[model samples]
Target: MKDTPRFAPDDRPSGGWGSLKAVAVSMFREEAPISTAHALLKQNKPGGFACVSCAWAKPAKPHAAEFCENGAKATAWELTDKRLPARFFETHTVSELQTWSDHDLEAGGRLTVPLRWDAGLDRYVEVSWEEAFAAIGAELRALQAEQAESVVFYASGRASLETSYMYQLLARLYGNNNLPDSSNMCHESTSVGLKQSLGVPVGTVTLDDFEHCDAVFFFGQNPGVNSPRMLHQLQDARRRGVPIVSFNPLRERGLVSFANPQSPLEMLTPAQTAISTQYLQVKNGGDIAAITGLCKWLIEGDDAALQSGARRLLDAAFIAEHTQGFEDFAAFVRRTEWAEIERESGLDRASLESAAATFAAAKSVICVYGMGLTQHRKGVLNVQMLTNLLLLGGHIGREGAGICPVRGHSNVQGQRTVGITEKPELAPLDRLAELYGFEPPRKKGLNTVEACEGVLDGSVRAFIGLGGNFVRAVPDTQRIEAAWQKLRLTVHIATKLNHSHLLPGEVSYLLPCLGRIEIDRQAGGAQTVSVEDSTGFMHASDGVAEPAEDTLRSEAAIVASIAQATLAPNPKVPWSQWVGDYALVRDAIEATWPEIFGDFNRRFRAPGGFQRPIPARHREWKTDSGKAHFATPADLRTDPDTPEPDADTLRLMTVRSDDQFNTTVYSLDDRFRGIYGTRMVLLMNAADIARLGLAEGAIVTAETAVNDGFHRAVAGLRVTTYDIPAGCAAGYFPECNPLMPLAHHAEGSKVPAAKAIPIRLRATKPA
Candidate 1:
């Protein structure tokens, strides 16, 4: 390791020099100026790049330093100075780049020029925009003419709403709606779960409601690392003396303590504030048991009311008026013996009782979750169960209360908001068709999972990705790569290079676009793009930096340009003007959802941005029954899709390192976990290691046993001791991504079981 001084992350304000330097260096793939990353970080225009890191929501408040350590690294990765000049490819073949590490490939820098794969040389050769576009158009046209079911369009969450909106429109216009969005791989389960329970696949919390909550229940999420921007809100709640309980498998640093780099004095002392009052390390899949135990402890428990005859318990009135299936849910809970619950949760009755006590004592509480709570076979049931818990506590409607699902991307929710969905309702499409003066496809398009299958079977031929590394993001990497190879054409509008770019077809093109921080000036004087955060809060993002390269264009412009080139005649929506001036696009958005985007441009002018309509604030339940309900799963151990593993094997999962985003590699090291210089490692508990007869740092080979022609396996991974459950193992994604069989995804949602890989581990050079 180099003994160079790298900027360290702090909780207090010193212009975030450390994080800025780290981010800027990696982004441009160059060292223009160390301080450039820091100065640009605070710039309002610079803050809009969707955080370039995790899918964590960007707050509506436009925080002074809205970004975090991981977020900064994400931005730097995009803003990197490293450029893949023509010669860089001359030195390395496609085969060579394929063998390169994730970090090494990323460090090769931004793809400044477009290139097409040279089949004979087994490498990529530089190509002009005209030729590249013509080749891509020809392939797509051929596929369309054949009425090909073998073609799919994969959309990434990293894409701007404008890009996504245009991509889907282009596909549908060309007579195919095989749009497989990023949600297929990540939060599709959340949508399935929430939709089953609440009708809408979104959270119901308003930020203002946090002011009235008495306690917060954080489940299956790591806020400190995954959503560091949310820490400020939690800290505010803590200052107000509200109890914050965290239930996660790993005890992360972000939840323990955070030194706010934006604080005026905290940086001087390097002082850190403890965040969570209680950190309950629940075992994996233990969420079901833990939640059940908490609910049981609250309902049929020893403690009934507070001292002096006050009713400080479950809200029976609310449960009766605003919910259903309590009797069935309670009876089901009764069937779950405490012994089994304790065994699965790894928590004794006392711990369960204690956690319930926190919720029981509070009048109003908020439950916040992420993909962790919903990425299971019973993910839908899991969501309903959480809703039941909240409703039972009368924690809907007022301040400091309601359900908060921290969205990962700045506009993932927005993408859905603008109709970039697979299982989209007929009403939205009808409305879109009516407004656009074109016939929309009534046929159900393939989702993320279905898209991969279509590709592998030769039914899906061509692919046009608006950002996202679909090939890398999808599970069963070998299968997806093979499927991608069968495609007639592939096009990606990206900021940086990833494995997805290498998933070539007969024809392919990589178009680098301007980053969120860069100034996007076209025919218009300036441009502002709309993005919806996790909270359903939409805001305008203006670019802050000069364009890295002239060839680079705004996502809006590129989408419009492609649309104009591909679609015959002119579009009715003034695609060209919308590209240069996104306000007109916001106007179009406002026309679609008036209740949410009212005064689309005017209200966004406010310093602290506005929020979208939250029906939950009024205790409004949109389900058919008009009440929050509970669902009892038919069976707990009957996940046939992701069947239980053999005794000798463990259920493995793939997770991102603290420093890494979805499939993008910012740094090879994960400083927080003490992992460095490598990602080819697995994290498991010491007891699991000992039981498997393996010493620390032992090399092991792990491969998924799912028999579906899916080679979700990787050989020779180093083992590292971590604070995890006995039967569980975790390795960084895209590396361990090989273990997640595409067919073994969650049942109802079909989201790749990235968090639930059934695998066997064998020690190499066993001690």
Candidate 2:
């Protein structure tokens, strides 16, 4: 059976089927009208159809779903016809819904009407928008005596720029930057790391760069699950003889063989194109050691050509001018012995040598990474190490060679570009002050981790979520659930019901809004909303379909109403005017963020959204020395949360099945990896299974021992051995979310350590 490889290596986290095939047969089936809308979504026109999944930008050309398969699932869920009416609210109390699984609650579909629970009735009865808004307004009014920071405004990447901008503006005008955004969960490291290293917290490459790369190195990320559209780029690179090197704990489906539904021949013949040319299975929490080893070999080892490669590799010129603390960093890399690297990374010397040789051979190598590398003890340093590698290759400021952080939200980068960040430096804040004629808050706001902590401490009384499902995105969900309950009120302005929405506050409100596919027909003929893509390119998203309901408002319109009721109106720009014409809001954005936003709309009329100036794109590194210097080295001790070095205590990583993306669950079935009707199955190596005293399909319980003596029992987990390294095991997120404690976040970025959790396994109690 091992020689035959019955499961095709079964390296992908779970599911192997095409994300689209899964979405097409699942989400799209639930709503066929959306199939037509997806085609229009790809057109680079100014309407509201951007991806609802990770922030990897939508393509200039519209496809069936300008989004990926996971995106379709997210959009379908957002645009789902099914509704949770008074009957659903009647049958399921807030407490009951709280007990529902993340999948079941979100899959229950859109919550059309507002709901508020009454203790007398014990059920959430439908409430009018006026009453709901009025109640929320009253609650905020009650907090007038308290400092504004007491109320937290959580932003989602899925929110329209208009909504996000207005939301940020309202928070600032209201006198607190308590903006806890989705960035805190995923790419905070990219933002913090890049800003510290390069003075700008955005990606250095564009979609155009994908075509130019001779080789693309992906680590700790599965584009098939997180950003599957990236598969097209990887697939094309395969045709061009461009090698894609993938380093992750598990082999990914997109990195293995992907049959693009977009390709005619592939669809006809079901021919699968090969992706990752070299697959490196670095163990969980092993990225630091793996990356450091690559640096060591390339710099000092017998593969001395890499030094010349490093000459072409190192932006030495950029380093000399723009960086500091490198001599120390260099010394640190030298001290890291190959033996230590091999043992820690769980990679044989041959494999490491092969990988180093591949990098040496490639002329222009683009190193792309995701959360796995960024949500650890040394996440910030890990990112800098990537730049250091690129810098060593002199890859920056060149086409097809740079560092890319594949963000998950559709407009997450855009949100930051338009000043949605909690940590705004003096320059952006001054710009906002100059453009808006008001002093924007200069104080930094709480990241997602701190925001949750505030909730736990009772300092934050309210949580106003603009879009994302916060609870699932946060680590240590038990702590999050308990903390969120302490809030005086929680108002979620969302398109669908998520698990976070069900984590009830004393008083809660769920407001349904129009999705990107749905046209926001108002006094205007057609309305257009702006969205930023991965590369900091902002484009207009205009909805082609009518609003799902007359009662449902655009996110902008919803925010405007809340603004009108909640705060005293400011005169710089009328909130009502901005809502009526999103262009007015864009004008404000242009004024606030100049140089880049100059001629924003006109520039977008050309190709692939408007391009933001990456200082490095012009060889203008925004680093202090005006060059691209590597970051100061950090001492990344092993994760304190890592289990004791014992046979039973193993490091666990959370991953996505091919059928799902981010927080949204597409289906229980993962066809490609052969998982069916469950998310709790553990993927361990066959050897590890024997070592751990387990058998095939034996149900196990994951017990997480953390502070407060917390114990989370993940029951009915069928142990399925896969081609994984000996010490690492894998499971899906939000399901295993209970295993991660709130304190396990990276200290520098506070990004949740979802990819690495120290855990133990045991047999589940017999049913």
Candidate 3:
């Protein structure tokens, strides 16, 4: 491993010359030029494919160059000239490939054909698509015959609307609702919180809202790495003189100033638009406290401030008219003390008051958050508190004012909208059963956490992953992989090679599928899939580039074919017709979810597509109370109740490197964090490092603080000092995933508290 730890801070993270250089390097590595240029120009456009990196919506009138640097990287990676032929799989054993790094595994190139694992030879051998499908079908049928609930169908956020709809239909028809998805691991908290508070599970704002907002509050998100396209929106918000206040444990580059690559002056010069007007380094797991503190201040203002005619900090009229639980919420806020808030939030009263003052002064505001707020034990409450803050000032149902949850995957929200959920609503189920003569399962199914537990207990006999690297993406990596190995059958439908493919079951198969940027031609004609963005706009995504390999099947085709083979005699749904004409799937979707997806085919072809109905957008609450509700605050007494802190103990947060998106690592270098040629590094506060008697670049190991009597540790991580909050440390995920206990998840959402892992760091003794 290269040991060069560059400590220079990146003044310009995503855009400017840095983005250009990164783009050039990615194109060179992927051998992309004419094909990439042709493909990129169409990405996020009216007649183009959605970017695979993020769920940020395409502007109604997108420019010719609508894609960002990371989007370009994703496009190049998808449209790479390199190919992983059948011979390559034949030459390497599963165990041998397991030794390869994640980047190396993907660097092997795109998968082109179906391959089945041969236990005797310990290698994967090429198999015909028909034979592979037939074998998988037989196993699934056998499992269903014995116990229908013994199978799990997992989906990645990369799944398109048509594919997601088909996958869920197949799962429900196959007598199982064990449809765990990537959302469970990331934004499940957002879904649960929003649904409870605002009567909508998605953000209520559109792309145009950013332009009108006076201030944007970013909590626990690094947009530069997670969603680079959002930088443009932030840049525009900043240019409009809107103050952006950031609340994060770590000082993220994306939350700092950013140089826009699209701007001629900034691109040519060294100037950059400042992103955050104030950056508050809140402690890990302290988001709820911070937000609640702000609310408390807004409710019971300073004596001096109140005397200065700043009495109407809270929108009493809006709260009385459009919200509930104000009295109880205000009582809790008034009772909560400043010392406790300061201790939990790691921010003094001055800072919290300043942020609250900024919000109070603004007429229109948008509260934005990511996994940082959601991946906590109180994740759902964290989200609700933000909504409460917004409701106090009437930040919803108006231009430039609403809640925004920045999703990691390009179509994660879209997948949920199209019924890729384990918890199926009664309306959708009723509609589905009415349209297709199948009784949908009523029992609540296994989520990501429960699925892993099910696999371990030998209850889930078979597993089928639609696109994501499930093993690596979920928490408790080693344990989850071991449980995954216990499966009787495992199948992965994917576009590229991942570690999950190597950790197969007794009967394992890899089914290659077409990517988003590739042509998806069927018997009828070229097909287009629709996806819902973060803002709820449903748009068409048509591939402009040729397939990496002709043998690769569309995700829709694979799902439909699997359903056809598994439910052969008389499938409830028209699998063959759906595969042949994707429009049929859209028709089915519209029939099922008519309220939102009416005329999907006809409307999706419109310039910017159609917006999904959001009652919250129009200040119409669909909740039981018929108004937005202020949910109870999380029990802040829990963390403080723990015995005095140990010297070695630190709060660990699993974070993404700048070179990666989710589990896909584009490179080892984290340019923003100043780490190079390695993923095995821990970012710690400089003062914390000094107190622990550890020098910079010191090799260390972090052990999880779980009382479950199981030892979980990640070793050989080099500690690097940074400007994070004291008692808080951060590290790259998948690498740090092993340190997260599955049981340590949010109360309601079950999203692993990846951002608030209790860890004990120790010096790594020389071997």
Give the candidate number with the greatest lDDT: 3
User: Residue-wise lDDT of candidate 1 within 590-677, one digit each (tens)?
Assistant: 7766777789889864544567776656777777898776777554441456555666677676777666777777676666666766
The list of candidate 1 runs beyond 4 A from truth reads 1-30, 38-50, 54-63, 302-312, 570-573, 638-646, 707-711
Query: Which 10-residue window in model 3 sums to the lowest lDDT?
Result: 636-645
What is the TM-score (0 to 1) of candidate 3?
Answer: 0.97
Residue by residue across 1-767, what tens digits does model 3's lDDT show? 54665666665655788888887788878887778888888999988899988888888788768988888988988998888988997788899999998888987779999999999999999999999999989998999999999999999999899899999989998987899999999899999999999999999988889989999999988888788888888998888889999999888887887888788989878788889999999999888789988998888873345578856777778888999998888888889999999988889999999999899999999999999999988888899999999998999998889999999888899889888888966238887888888788988888999998897789989999999889988888888887887789999999889999999899999999999888899988999888888888998999899999889999989888888788745556778888989999999899888899988889998877789999999999999999999987745631332244577778889988877878888888888887778888888999988898888878888998766877899999988888889998999988999999888888789998899888988798531
TM-score of 2: 0.93
lDDT of each residue in 578-598, candidate 2, tens digit only: 888777887887787768789
* Steric clash count of candidate 2: 28
> How does residue 596 of candidate 1 score in lDDT?
73
Query: Global CA lDDT of candidate 2, please?
Result: 0.74
